[model samples]
Target: MTDRTPPAPSLAQLRALIAVADAGGFGEAAAEYGVSQSSLSEAVAKLEALAGRPLLRRTPGGTVPTEAGARVLTHARAAVQAAADALLAAQEENGGLSGTLRVASMRSAATHLLPPALAAFRARHPRVTVALLDSDAGGGGAPAVRSGRADLAVILADEAPDLRLSPLPPDEYLFVAPAARGTHPVTLAELGAAPLILPPHLDSCYRRIRTYLAARGVSLTAVSEVEQDSVILSMVGHGLGVTVMPRLALLPLPPGLVALPLPEPLARPLALAALPHRAGLPVIRAFTQAVLSHLPVPELPAKEPGPLPVPVSAPPLN
Candidate 1:
């Protein structure tokens, strides 16, 4: 048997190493963990030395785990999770759900859904801090939830997930343009003729919009593609072209634009997702409750099922 000193690896070292690997770079990992790169690097180096083998390899784009590094990372993540579970369990035993509640959401949700709920939630749980982020489009919210950086995510739901997800409330898609343009609703076939501003191909809204139109044998003529709601709304306000956006986005509409409900009645269901292990936490439960209490659901069509316990709120308009 070989005699080797079993190094005591600190949680900090494991976290630094994991963050760098997940973030794909030292700078990003350091920023995420609120540590200087040098400090993070030192911690990672110490971890590698303790492990008795090199665990990571520096690449042009970022750092990647070598074969040995991947093993270390897997175990490190497990250990970190165990430690977190222990801490959360201890907190539960000693106190109530009182800690920072990190939330990641899309911009439209941030603008319309979060404010009132957050305000009410704050009044109820004054000790629990809230951190909300409008993460990148294309559902980058997944990373925030998976990384433990966010306790909960209110986002466009992916059909299949590696995490537990619960549907919040449904939001509708609308073909919005300047109100001065017209009152009559335009069909997808007719609107396919006009130049359009649209979401990027990878965006859930864009993909769903495409699928709906495609199913009806229609397609919008694209003038340009943009990633955020604000840009699309601004372009519509300027009469650059019409764009399809969630009705919730109407809350932040520029002066000249108006949103008309789509005839198709296609509703995108939003969801709250967290690691399955974290689903039972009070913070997650409270956050989910806060979400259910805030989403401004639209009127359901006669044939459709009644809206979920959608909070009574005004139309998705300013």
Candidate 2:
């Protein structure tokens, strides 16, 4: 009698699984990989057959990995990344850099921080393609890098302790309220006077602000929790309430509003995150240098010794 053994999964199948999971649906994944949905689905089906278990589940929200699927995905991502690195290494040996460098970043950073750096990197390594994935959720960038969906992630500093981080200048948080309220360094009392409108509790910036205020014996609750920075600003503009947000998110502050320093200054530190093992890759190194070279050092507001009662001129908005 001859023994029959199951076929080993191919790298193509592994990549298909990763793509579906990351993209969150068969149609989207197919579009991204430039393959038909049937082909992508077949690849994942084959992978599941080899493992003898269901890997993905369909839901109203989107396709998501099942528990077993999630476990397999971690290995799939590692395997796919390793294969890419091997290919990249071979290409680098020829003294040329050619491949995609995926970067995950929050929307604000993507808008304000990455353009110059990306332009500089493209100029230096025209052969290498750069993909920017917008991750709007707080600290969403770190998870994308950890899952091997991105080579680098622009995120809050110290957001992921296990990942290697390259720190960038911090973005100061400012108190924003109606211009009718008058422009003055906000007192702790005034901060609590208005019904607070703030980012969702899951937001890293919100957590930082909450913690900082908690330490100072200030406990305030948000009357409305919003995720979009622009919406929050608009809400404040309409006198819904006041908010504290990172300076980068409040740029070009809407007309009829003012931003002032908090009674005690606070800031959100930013960083580029990468898996420790891949931190030394030539492409990663090149892009890191580009970011450092092109990103201007932010001019943070000077720290006040204490809250001032007199109104101060609001900083110029550009």
Candidate 3:
């Protein structure tokens, strides 16, 4: 003899059970779902057959769930709510913008660049939540977006094809030194001659400062490598050494540090990256719009031949 397996309950069956409990009768439940009373009854009957137990009782107090029906309806209500939430998420992708977004970013950019953009984003989309995750330039982000740990990442425009990239402002490299050194618009060759503090050569930038120097017949001398941009900026501010890094990295430079734009700017394109399909979602669109609307690509200023104003709002490391 061949074995026959029962089919699992469909969404229709589950909805019928929950509606019947709420509306208290097959006719009322059918009206709620815009279906015929007979169809609703049949759907509940299928649920009972699948569970191998009766799920409803006729009582003077309209229609009531039997003990078994009460238990099954509890699960049915939960499943229904989950379905509604799933649909709501899909709707949000279209135009229903109210959900939390998990965002990923590298340490330097997160500390210096993202704050203003995020604050602007919050001002615009007060209902949306953006959770930022700090990552090493080369790691932490890939696994995050791939494993559903993050919805978006701000990374270099051309770094990863899998992460669909949308352009933000490209960040230009700057020569950073102690203010007491009295910035006189130092050239790359002059910067190379100073005691240098720097981060390890990284992937998004590929040792940006060094690569540019290599191209210009310059080389590091009396150099010290620190692993964090914030630390490097701090070291440079303290007059230990001078360093070259993205202008965005030394933003709001500490009390004693100063930035000089390179004569020939060395820069890396930064962009919003996400699983290709996620780029168009409403929350992501909102974030990207906020970024574009606020942070314009900084046009390199004329070389400041003297000490400029120190930004009082700079973060504490320096």
Model 1 C-alpha lDDT versus the unseen true structure: 0.74
Instruction: Rate residue 299 of model 2 by lDDT.
Output: 60
TM-score for candidate 2, please give it.
0.83
- How many clashes (backbone N, Cα, C below 3 Å) per candidate? 0, 0, 0
Per-residue lDDT tens digits for candidate 2, residues 1-318, read: 776885778999999998998899999999998999999999999999999999999999999999999999999989989988876655552376888899998776776777878876776688998988877743488888988878999888766889989988788888888888875567887776678888888777778887887888875754578988889999998999999988778766788788888887799889999899888888887788788787755664456422212322232212
Q: In candidate 1, what residue range of length 10 has the lowest lDDT sum?
A: 302-311
List, residue by residue over 138-219, the lDDT tens digit for candidate 1: 3467777776667787766765378788886677777777768765666776568767788888777888887877888876
Model 1 clash tally, residue pairs? 0
After aligning candidate 1 to the native by TM-score, how far in Å is the CA of 107 from where it should be? Answer: 1.3
Q: What is the Cα-based TM-score of model 3?
A: 0.63
Instruction: Give the distance in Å from residue 111's predicted Cα in candidate 1 to where it truly belongs.
Output: 1.8
Which residue pairs in candidate 1 collide? none
Question: What do the candidate models score in CA lDDT, each in turn?
Answer: 0.74, 0.81, 0.72
Candidate 3 segments whose C-alpha is farther than 4 A from its true place: 1-89, 92-96, 123-125, 137-143, 202-206, 296-300, 303-318
Candidate 3 residue lDDT tens string, 60-141? 7778899999888777865665564464446553344677778888776776667777887676666777888876743666
> What lDDT is obtained when candidate 2 is compared to the true structure?
0.81
